[model samples]
Structure formats: C-alpha cells, structure tokens
Target: MLEFFNDTQTIHFIIIVGSMSLFFIGFYGIATQKNLVKILVSFDIMESALFLFFIGLHYKVGLVAPILDKHLKTFTNMVDPVPQAMILTTIVIGLAVLALGLSFGIEYYKLTGRNDISKMNELRD
Candidate 1:
C-alpha cells in the first residue's frame, strides 16, 4: 500500500492527491460549517495542509536536519529551511488570528447567548 507512494513514478501524484484532499476537506468545512470556531479550525487545517505539501516537496530519500554545526551531517543531505521558517511564522500568525477570532466569538456569544449565526437577529432591522 505505502510502497506505491515511495516509487518515484507515483510520488508526485501521491503528494498532490494527499495535499489536495486535505485542502478540499478544509475548504468544505469552511464553506459548510456554521460555528465560528469550526470555520477558524478549518482554516488552520488548510494552513497545515499547505505546510505539509511544502515539506513533502523537498523530501528526499535520506535527508538530515538543516542544523548549522561542525558535523558533516549524514548519508544524504539537507532540503531547505525557508519553508520551515515560513511555516513557523504562519503557525504563529494563525494562532494570533484564531485567538482574535475566538475573542470575537466569545463576545458574540456573551451579547446574544447563542453560538449560531442564524439566531443572531439582534442587529437586524
């Protein structure tokens, strides 16, 4: 089962399908989920999927961690570190955005005593 993905002929296809699946599932949740928190989580899932795809792209047969030390590393070599940095930044930003969104969600719940948007009829004319 897993051996097919290891084959060079199908690695790219596997990565594409897996990453697209993750993205599509996240997109579906964003489009269909009603709860504010659920939507935010879906966005996070999408972000994670992108990061996974990035790391998967540079993945080699036996790559070592890109640590700058005196040692010569290992049998293979290092991929790239830019994606790691970008993913770290993205995860932090995502946390900040999620926190802000949750704060707004809490405020809405407090003001209306409800979590569903359909029931939020206080501001409607």
Candidate 2:
C-alpha cells in the first residue's frame, strides 16, 4: 500500500476519485432532493469538483505560478496557467449563480409560504 502513496500516480488517482465523488454527491442532491436551497448547494458542489479536477490535472510540485516578476525571468516546470484562469472565471460564475438561485429560493419560499416543492404546486387548482 505504501507504493500507492507515491506522487507519480497517486495524485491523479486522487483527483479522479475526488471529482467522481463530487459528481455523485451533487447529482444525488440535485435529483432526489426537493429543496431549492439544496439544489443550489449541489450546484455549488459540482462547480467545486470541476475546479478541483482541473487544478489537480495541471498541478506539479516545485513549480511556480505564471506571475511575471523581475527576478524570475523564466518558468521552471510551472503548470499551465490557462486552466487556472478558466477556473477563476468558473468560480466567479458559480458564485453569481448560487447567489441568484438562493435569492430565488428565498423569494419562492416567501411567496408560497413554504419551502417544499410539493406544497408549492397548488396553483393549478
């Protein structure tokens, strides 16, 4: 089992496992749960998973960030910066979406006087 602790392959394995677990948990929360707040939270979890997967795939030990400094003229096995930038955008978008979704959920609860989806569907009558 000690061999599994090696970074050459274990890091990627962990990244995959983490991503899969996140997806499963998020899916379950979104599909089986009826609470709007929970669904939003699940969405947030999914976003986190994607970000983790990306960062993990691009990560490398003893590497520096792509920030340009007067001292560090060139990169030394630095990981890709594109993924980091994309993840940043994704994170911001996720926050905005979660904020919007939660506010909508709150409004929904206020208008209907209930947070349960089943109880809110009496409008057809």
Candidate 3:
C-alpha cells in the first residue's frame, strides 16, 4: 500500500481521474440545471478541472521549481514553468469570463424577475 501510494504514476493516475470526474460532474450540472447561476457555476467547475488536470499532469515527483541560484544554476532538473504560467493566465481570463457571465445573468434576472433558463424566451423574437 505504501509503495503504491508513493509511485509517481499512481499520483498522476489519481489526478487524471479526479479531474475527469470533476469535469463530468460539471457537465452533468450544466446539462440538468435550469438556473442560470447553476450553469455558470458548472462552467467554472469545468474550467477548474481543466486547470487542475494541466497543472497536475505537468508536475513531477523530484523536480524543483524553475529558479536560478548559486546551488542550482541550471534549468535542467527544474519543473517546466510554462504550464504554470499558462494556467495562471487562464485563471485570470476565466475569472473575467465568469464575471461577465454573472453580470449578464444578473441583468437578465433583473429584466425578467427570474433566473431560470427555460423561462428565458426574451431573445426568441
């Protein structure tokens, strides 16, 4: 059990499975939820799952952060910083999009006095 838990492959497998599960949960929520807020939340959940999958997959067991110092001058053993940076940028963009979506939802709710997707027929004309 100890050996199994300590294996890098096992860790990666767990991350992949966990992220996939989260993504599907989000997808299910989006598919079944009638409320606009719930759908937006589901979208956020899916985004989070993708972020987790990317970051988790890029991680290595024995790698250090990509930093330069006297003790570690080379970039050889350091973990790749590109994925982390990309995830950070993605997080910012995701937040902006989520905020925009929520603002639209709020406006729609204000105009219609309801937040249910099924009842949103204002744009059907």
TM-score for each model: 0.81, 0.84, 0.92
Model 2 agreement with the true structure over 29-91: per-residue lDDT tens digits: 888888777777888888788889998888765577888799888776678999999999988
Clash count for candidate 3 is 0
Backbone clashes for every candidate come to 0, 0, 0
Q: What's the distance in Å from true for residue 8, model 2?
A: 2.9
**Candidate 2 segments exceeding 4 Å error:** 1-4, 69-71, 122-125
Report how far off residue 49 is in candidate 1 (Å). 0.9
- Which residue window of length 10 is worst by lDDT in model 1? 68-77
lDDT of 1 by residue, 1-125 (tens): 77765664477567778998999999999999888888888988898889888877766655677875677745347867888888889889888988899999999988878887656678679
Residues 1-125, candidate 3: write the lDDT tens digits: 58888778999999999999999999999999999999999999999999999999988889888888889877898778999999999999998999999999999888889999888787798
Q: Which regions of candidate 3 deviate over 4 angstroms? A: none
Better of 2 and 3 by TM-score: 3
**Candidate number with the higher lDDT (1 or 3):** 3
Candidate 2: clashing pairs of residues:
none
The TM-score between candidate 3 and the true structure equals 0.92
Query: Which 10 consecutive residues of model 3 have the lowest summed lDDT?
Result: 1-10
TM-score of 2: 0.84
